[model samples]
Target chain A: DTAVSQTPKYLVTQMGNDKSIKCEQNLGHDTMYWYKQDSKKFLKIMFSYNNKELIINETVPNRFSPKSPDKAHLNLHINSLELGDSAVYFCASSPRTSGRAQETQYFGPGTRLLVL
Target chain B: DQQVKQNSPSLSVQEGRISILNCDYTNSMFDYFLWYKKYPAEGPTFLISISSIKDKNEDGRFTVFLNKSAKHLSLHIVPSQPGDSAVYFCAAPCGGNKLTFGGGTRVLVKP
Candidate 1:
């Protein structure tokens, strides 16, 4: 069984199209996160949610938004996608009991998106 | 500005040898360091981590060394095997629950 999973492992869309990526974790974690690994292979944190509460938002653009319906799932939606948005997006989860900032995070297989 | 940096984009090591990957950070507030290993199509897996209070932490064949004064940390893999070849990322918690990651370093173990 996968500890963390994402739907539509591959997504291809035209520029300006709207798209979404879904994530779920079965590890009973209270914190979830979204990361984008660009062509430079730098995995940058995009957003973080703890128990359905938004806790961290990086310098990402307004076109990207993250939603956490519950502790087990966090979804990312993009509007007016651009060529720069083409990258691998990953979902991660971690227990908040340990210091939320320093605890180990478990990541899901990335969703590779291609924007034409 | 990039807080965490992995200058080496790639590395090559022979089997049964030692592989050392280096990382540097500009943020002094980071008290914890971590390394994540990622295969071609899979997500990153937590490999090892070292707390600021300690200089070193070891698990199995992996060891993480932290030098607070130098603002540097490294991952050492002993007796490197083919299975150990993957992209390794250096990371640290930024302000809250989020982490700042360095550009990954790809390691290839030659048999």
Candidate 2:
């Protein structure tokens, strides 16, 4: 069984269009995050939610939003997608520990977004 | 600015040889560090981790060494196999639920 899974493994959209990627984790983790890997293969964190609460918001644009309805799911919605948005979107989950952050994040297969 | 950096973009090793992947971080606030391995078409998987309190952590054939003073960390894989070929990433927690990842190093283990 896959611990973390994402829908629409591949997404091809056009500029000025909007799209959403869904992520779900069965590991019962308390924190979920979204990361973007550009063509240069630089992985950077975009957003993070702890128990459905927005905890960490990176320098991502306002056009990108992350919603976590519950602890098991976190979805990313992009508005007016641009060509620069062509990259791999990865969803990750990790258990929250007391005081110290020693948890290992588990990542999903990732959604390859192609903006044409 | 990128807090974490992997200077080496790629490395090649022969079977039964040791593979050493290095990483460096500029942030002193990071208390925990981790190494993740990724194969093509798949997401990165956690391999090993080392806490700031400890300088070294070993798990079977994989060992992680951290030097807080130098802000450097390295993952050593003993007797690397062809199956060990993949992209390895170094990561550190920037804060609550936020992890800063390195540029990644692709390791190719040949037979």
Top-DockQ structure, candidate number: 1
How many clashing pairs does model 1 include? 0
lDDT: worst 10-residue window of model 1 chain A: A94-103
The sequence of per-residue lDDT tens digits that candidate 1 reaches over residues A1-116 is 89999988999999999999999999998989999999988898899999999998988999999999889999999999999999999999988775534368999999999999
Give the clash count for model 2: 0
TM-scores of all models? 0.96, 0.96
The residue ranges of model 2 lying beyond 4 angstroms of the native Cα positions read A99-102
> What is the C-alpha lDDT profile of model 2 across B1-83, one tens digit per residue?
88999999999999999999999999998889989999998999999889999999999989999999999999999989999
Q: Which parts of model 1 are misplaced by more than 4 Å?
A: A100-102
For model 2, how does the per-residue alpha-carbon lDDT over A1-116 read when each residue is reduced to its tens digit?
Answer: 89999998999999999999999999989999999999999999899898999988989999999999999999999999999999999999988777544368899999999999
In candidate 2, the residue pairs with backbone N, CA or C atoms under 3 Å apart (3 or more residues apart, or in different chains) clash, namely none
lDDT of 2 at B106: 98
Error of 1 at B96 (Å): 1.0
TM-score of chain A of 1: 0.95
Interface RMSD, prediction 2: 1.2
**CA displacement after TM-score superposition, residue B8 of candidate 2 (Å):** 0.4
DockQ of 2: 0.78
